[model samples]
Target: MATAEKDGKIYCRFSRPKSLASMKVEEEDDPSGPTEITIDLSSGKVIFIAVGKTYNGGNDLAEHVEAPVLSSGKVDFSQFKVARGTTMTLLTQLHGVAMVLAWMLFVSFATVEGRYFREGFGSKMVCGLKLWFQMHRVVTMIAGILTAAGFILIFVKVKGLSKNAQAHTYIGIIVMAATCGQIFLGLIRPDATAGWRPKFNWAHRLLGKATHILAAADLILAFRLPMVSPEMRHFGTTVVAVWISVQVVWEVTFEVNKYLQSKSPKVDSIPGKEETKIEEKVIWKDPNGRLQLILCILFVLTIVSCSVATLCAILIF
Candidate 1:
């Protein structure tokens, strides 16, 4: 890295390595010259000049040139060295892991305890209380804690919400708030004896469903951030695809089991009454099929959106 003064204006130049140069330019277009980054210290503006053409400082070079050189005509030579990554980057990865694990646990609880074991397997109680209820409570609490901690780490590293992080920050905040509301509603859930039981149940269910969708969206949006790596983003996409497949399979199985149970014959006997009653109780059901269809459509759209966004981010950086 070198700095120069011409016509009383200061400019900083960065020497491009062979590897980076080859990556940036085709063999035919290669100038066999170093790329120069010019910083206007007075105005705090920076630009890149290569192959006799100038380009504005985009996201890829912004981290290296913007702050240090723009602030004081001084480029930190240390930054040019091959990076081993940063602690903050590792923290962000950990945060993603925690959140993803939490989500997986949540999905397992909803599928196994809520639908499979409860409805298909005809399990009533596991530890005195309903199996689904116990698992849901435990898994959701862990998820909520992980979400909160991950959200806090963003602010801690960035010092404050940066412009690039605005969308992610807002969505994360909304998800956390919704999670709190979900926990509160779950705790205050009413029993069959209460007059407001139906209304309460509907509200709780709706809120929980919305929170899960929003949280998934938030996870996808994270891939757009600059600090995240492309390999990591691709891995995220794979994980999401697997999660979607699991959900689809679980939903189909649940629906099939429910239909079969409804069709099977049932008999209830009562003394002094020559009438038989048939009753079927299903723990999970989509009455109109509209909600399930809409949710599946949304999941597909989200996956496409995240994949496209990840590609765009990779191109930009």
Candidate 2:
């Protein structure tokens, strides 16, 4: 058999013994239309025929459906629904869950705790480390793990970089690289008294904030990719918008509060003299620490809700 094209239409030719041949004309422009076939016989006669539209593998070309798997004595995949796309799979769903939890929830909370909640926790120690530092370290560790795991899952599913999802894929690679670098830097952080400690702190904070921003951007790009369903894309976009808005509000409110706290006057007294009002720079202590706690709690709740909503959008479709 051989194929040819005439007038922008494809024709498949089949040759048989005894001087016989056949040609099938396919609907190139509109596969939903009827097909035509011609047969040439040894007696110098031709037969022309028409048939209804034939199967064109449209669904297969458009999307891929994962096969059900049986493992560990039973099949468990039936309980979960799989979305229809080349990039939508059980692994991709899990990847989305991991990323949302990592970047949007854990990392966001960790950044807030380290940045603004230090005064709230004071010098309180947990396991010989400052309370804020401990919480930040632990939460960031979880986020790092999730970020790495999600990267691995998607890489395994795709088997290589994706050409169609260039924006998401490249941004994800950069985010993953930054995350790994941040983790390494955190693990080898210098003591406060070290001359280079300030430099390390700046590098750490900047890398972390940049990674978080890139990860968020990658998520938004993922939603815009062709493989994602329209419903999932819309839902994910809304969730990201709300999460970003809350983060911005939380940061601005705390910064303003910190500024006001720094400028407030404090009462001072001598051993044998009257009390005096002194203007001092109180950078480390926040008189409105309670407000920080309240706002932090609300911000955390919003992150969790957004993460869960985004996960459901990826998994349920």
Candidate 3:
């Protein structure tokens, strides 16, 4: 097949075989009406039939034309198979996977582990740096790098940004920008004693959460991108579901712990004052809280369900 343009209209010509005496070409300009072409090849001369339509030299060609049926003898057209080695498709898939995994690692491992350190549940110091802060910083840095790389890859693959880009593309840009802003805010985060500390902290938390949610949505949208296979779509959906489940479990656990800790009585005393009397705080001990137990069971069930469903989909589909 060859395509050419003349007189502001596009034309595509398919080479005919010698054994094919006559053939009919049909083009669907609309769902209800199709344009047809009849070629008489009985004169033993090579004839080229041009379909008067504007071809954008993309996958739209496949949508416009129907499969050709030879009137005479069978002709093998396997040689015209579309090549699948294009850089755009490969780079898009790479960008999608890399960005998805990077964000997943940030949410599932880095953020959760950092919280553990922050809450004094783990060792505070690691190799001279504060464990929580360092883990958060490193993971965020890696995630930012991956996001930037994927963002650039998309632009490179598309040659430049298009005004008519998909919603996912726009959302990705916003997510990357928000991530960069979040990183900057984190670097200049004030100490607990600072007046602006609470405000900054809330802003940082909210922005980070929003960015993660948007990133998850962007990953789901990637399944709808051109050239993505059904199996890959299912895989992407599974990853999104797993990430969401982990996030819900972590958030619920954190909230429950916070609520329990708030119920404990606090100590009131000055550390270095001579006239001050220190009053000890009452600690609440509940190793097996009902809410915690229920959340854990739910979390476990979610993980199991996601795993089984994903495996079944892979096998069945």
The global C-alpha lDDT for each of the candidates, from Candidate 1 onward, is 0.55, 0.74, 0.60
lDDT of 1 by residue, 10-120 (tens): 777666532322122122234553354443333322223222222233322222211111122233443543222221244554566556655544543453344444432
Summarize candidate 2's per-residue lDDT along 1-317 as a digit string, tens digits: 99999999777766476443333334334455434344434343312222233235431121222222212122232244322233255687788889999999998888888887787877899988998898889899999899999999999998977555577899999999998899789879999899999999999989988888888888888788754556778888888887888887877877777776665667777788888897666655545566777877888788888888888777665
TM-score, one value per model: 0.56, 0.68, 0.59
**Candidate 2: segments with Cα more than 4 A from true spot:** 1-87, 163-165, 264-278, 281-288
* Count of clashing residue pairs in every prediction: 0, 0, 0
lDDT of 3 by residue, 1-317 (tens): 99999999787777775353332223333454423434344443222222233333432322312112112322234444322222124465557645755676545445555543364424568787677777777888887888889888888988887765788888988998997898799779888899999899789878887888888788667655544445656675775677576777777776666565554444555578655435535354344455545544565455445434543332332
RMSD of 3: 11.8
What is the Cα-based lDDT of residue 88 in candidate 2? Answer: 53
Angstrom error at residue 226, model 2: 0.4
Point out where model 3 deviates above 4 Å.
1-88, 120-123, 126-128, 261-263, 266-317
Better of 2 and 3 by lDDT: 2
Best by TM-score: 2
Best by lDDT: 2
Ranking by lDDT: 2, 3, 1
Off by over 4 Å in 1: 1-61, 64-83, 86-88, 119-128, 263-317
Candidate 3, clashing residue pairs?
none
